[model samples]
Target chain A: MIQAISASDYLQPVHDGAALPPLEAALKNLCRERFRRIDRFIQLALLGSARCVAGRTLQPDCGIYLGSGLGPIGNNILTQQQLIRDAEIPKPVNFVNTLGSSAGFHVARNLGLRGQNFFISRRGASLQAVLGAAMADLTHGVVGQALVGVVEEVTLPLGEHRLRQHLPEDRTLAEGSHWFVLQPGTGDSRSLDLKRFAEFATLEDFLKSVWRTGDRLCCARSMETHAAKTMQRGFDAGALSGPTSAFHDSLEAAWLAAFAVSREPGTLFLVDGHPERGWSLFYLGA
Target chain B: MAGAYIRGVGLSCALGEDAESGVSAMQRRQVRPVVLRLDEFDEPLQMPYYRIPDRAELFDAGRLERLLPPVARAAVAQAGLTPEEIHRLPLFIGSSCFSIGLSESRYAAALAHQSETAIPMPLCGYQDIAAILQRALACRGDTYTYNTACTASANALLGALRMIELGWYRHALVVGAEWANRTTLAGFSGLQIVADALRPFDAARKGIVLGEGIGAVVLSAETDSANRLRVIGGASNCDTWSVTTANTNGKSVAAVLNQALEQTHLRPRQVRGIKAHGTATPAGDTAEALGIRQVFAGLPPLSVLKPYLGHTLGACGINELILFAGALQRSFLPATPGFETPDPALGVQPIITPEAAPDGHYLLNHFGFGGNNTVLVLEKTAP
Candidate 1:
């Protein structure tokens, strides 16, 4: 078991064809020059991770597990265009940013750490898979600490084709970055345990076993149908209405869950689901 | 860490369709250049690559659907596993191009305002490699796909090892598949790294020949088994000095090598051989050479597979790893066929002639863009 030490999120509402979220001052605070030419997916990931380790002492041995719905899609499109249309050579930054793992290196360089860095792309389940892997690594003593995170950028091809395929129109195309520190321990009385289920037979079976009677439910918009029905069935639910209630992606759902858990000190079940990818249920708080 | 044995390995590359034949060709120093005709270019662009023969027809069925399943099935069969067992075993896959070859053509069709309905659903995402493999192999367990440039599949192996060590799963299948695509070809062409011939670790080495192949390995936690090679330990780290290139000093690369050795509880002298990730690129060769020297006082007999297999990119991790294990079992190290004169700057010489396989552990390295570096220690245990 591992404790969630800290959590940070950098989310932006992206309209259908909006450009990638502008790099905020938080990202500029750490490594402004380094963030210049990189794509927006990378910028969001680093910005969120920077906030995650903000006031805390940096752990050089900490690993980074980044999950992206579409790895470097923006840069991939740009590089493809340059090669086909302009017949121009790819710039150094364009080539580098086009790689899938570039964001992990960017975060690690800014944080000045050297440890295992893994970048996985699982489309809808990217965040869930990364978090599960992070918890397993921490439980196995793979590292002293880990920055487990996810970043998704609303590029035209990605937002229209990939994200919109699964998400309903009400949800809108979303992009954000979320990061948390995973450390070994039960932490405190209010710390919620993190467990990875290889295969879950049903959400009800999972809830009946671990969830307390008063545990609140938080979920991504993708899970609205099932989650709504489950909540209506009256199974330990709360916080359906709040300021941070509108969440489109897994990162936003996780960020809101973390924030709610920290403030209220109660159960916050963050559920993210995709038919093709399966379900990721995060039990937060005590 | 818990012990993970390489119970089975499967491969389909330029050398051969199976591990044994690929190893045989390597030992025999067979050389060939497979070519892919890019229809996108106007003036007949036939890019040279290490492509599997007669797989283009399979691409018509589906790109990843063609390459991934056969290799995965072969690996599972060699492991003496059934479809029922595979349904329970989680999958960890890595690839730089997961059917991107098919996607490129579809994207072009879309760009030309053609009907996008012709594109298959499987070609849409990189995760399709795992998805297709899972359905084909009856593996419904958890799946993870790593895409860290060239080091992708190596990192996937590391993940499988760590998870098995944590007792998360008793067995996991690690698979890697990269196919030749116009986008990747254009990308590398723009970088100007494609060499006329691959001459890894050679003084006159030019650059790299892009290749495409698929490789798979079945890893089980059961020790005291009859597997020939076992994954003892490994490490992966990134150098932030550059994204497209390695840190010139090779400090991070050296650290990862030391880390793998330390974790495996082995000394430099204990390792009998090394499989260098010699891409034949000038900067890549230099960094790897320096890193190897820093780890071992007198480097063990080293070999470069890229000369024989070409640079398979993401798939090279599993492809080269399986071939290495096969070569050791055959009691012969494949010669670096193109190596004539060693670069004095590297201060190391690759095994230009095939040599008798030494019994012990071997160090395997795979470095990629964004400075992702991985080193694995594999022990050749007596059956």
Candidate 2:
């Protein structure tokens, strides 16, 4: 079992015509030193990770598993513009920050960690991907402590952003950085477990045994409609719904992190998979 | 530790289109890099590039569609997996340039005609490669796409190995792909690191020659009778010293090397040969050399592969691995073609001629931007 000791969620809805709110003050207060040659994505990552740590001493070997759907989009956009639109080579700092791992590098340096650092992506399901990878490492004893995070940056000019993502014109947008510090063993903190079942019947049976009065259930967006409906009907507790007014590439992270930071009374059972590919249930005990 | 067997392999790079041909071309010491000139910039940019031998346009959007599938199919075919097994096979993909070339083409076209509605990034996400593979192979299993610079694929392989060791799955497909893109080319040129030739560990080494490759390997928990290579354990760590390069002091490099060696339960003398990252940049070679020296008293036969295939960046991890494993299977180690003069400051040298590759363990070093360092261990036995 893995324990979720701390969580930090910085999610703000971005108005269609307004500029992104400044992060300089928040970052200045949170960061150890002024970091130059950094972009917005790196800033968000550092802010979330530092907030999650909250001055608590972390193990030197804590692994960092950072997940994203559209990684470092702001810096990438600027870099691409520099190369194609302006007909000039990208600046060194902009080019180096284009890689997704650059954010993880800053987080590691800030926390004084020298363990496994990975930047993984799976589009809409990036949270599940990174969470699974971190849990696997924790289970296999690769790292006793894992710092897992999922960040999605909203680029300016809402029209362009929406066009890039192929979303509807009026779809509301938001930027988010959700982080969690996970470790092995159960304690007073919330316990997280991942279970896999090859058949729907097996999954239903397992959920039936673990179901409680106030436990909530959330079906991943990728889950088949009929399967999701079936699971929703089986669980008496209310279904957990994601943010309806705002959008990000990895909405699952928002749902999970919201639940983690909430005062929910029971476990949140998150179901994800396909009938042909088997089922995965991420159990977060309250 | 019980490691995963390397069941199948496929590669496409400057050396050749397929794995066997690539190893054969390397054994014959073929080092070729075409001069690439980009005139679209304010100042005309020219550099040496090692591209795949395909006759298509370098920036053709359809290049990835045509190239990635065949390489993946070749690996799956060689594995001889059943229909059911292939359907549930997990995918672990690593790449630095994932569909950015496609994005650039779309944006540039938009700018040419529809400048009013043009967007800088029309397609922004890292799932293009994975989605393409899934559609081509008809697999819907879990996918993990890594973007950790040059060490991307090595870390992907480590993820697969650990999951398989934990009995999570019977088989997994790991792919490392780097395709040509203006962003990568111009970006490296802007860093002032693209050199005329890759001279790793040589005194006159200036910088790296960027290249592109697409390589895939199928790993299984069980080994067949013909399997001779197994991916043992590996380790990855962050330097925290510099994001653009590893600490030139080599302490962080030495730490990761020691961590990998300790995890694999092998001493310095036990490793048969070493495949250095060998980007040929002064600081990169210095860090790798000093780290290797700190770990091993008597240096093993070192091989630098970037000379033959060019620096494939993120894809070099698996591209070089397949080449090295193929040489081991053939009972010989590859030679470093660009090592004419060794640097005394580094106190290391690569083998100038091919040597016997005995059945033993070997380490492959991979370092990338963002302070990422990874070392993979491979064991060879008589087939």
DockQ of candidate 1 is: 0.45
Which is the leading candidate under DockQ? 2
Candidate 1 per-residue lDDT over residues B39-122, each given as its tens digit:
544454555688776546523536567667888988888888765677677788888767666665555555567544322221
Per-candidate Cα RMSD to the true structure, in Å, reads 3.6, 1.1
* CAPRI class assigned to model 1: acceptable
- List model 2 lDDT by residue over B1-383, tens digit each: 47999988989999999999999999999999999999998789999999999999999989999999999999999998888888999999999999999999999999999888789988899999999999999998899999999999999999999989988888999999999999999999999989899899999999999999999999999888989999989999999888878998888899999999999899999999999999999999999999999999999999999998998988889999999999999988899988899799999999999999999999999999999999999999987
Kindly list the interface RMSD, in angstroms, of each predicted candidate in the order they appear.
4.0, 0.7
lDDT of 2 at B252: 87
Give the poorly placed runs of model 2, Cα more than 4 Å off: A239-242
Across A126-165, the per-residue lDDT of candidate 1 in tens digits comes to: 7767877777777767677888888766665433444324
* Residue pairs whose backbone atoms clash in candidate 2: none
lDDT of 1 at A223: 55
Per-residue error for A274 in candidate 1, Å, reads 12
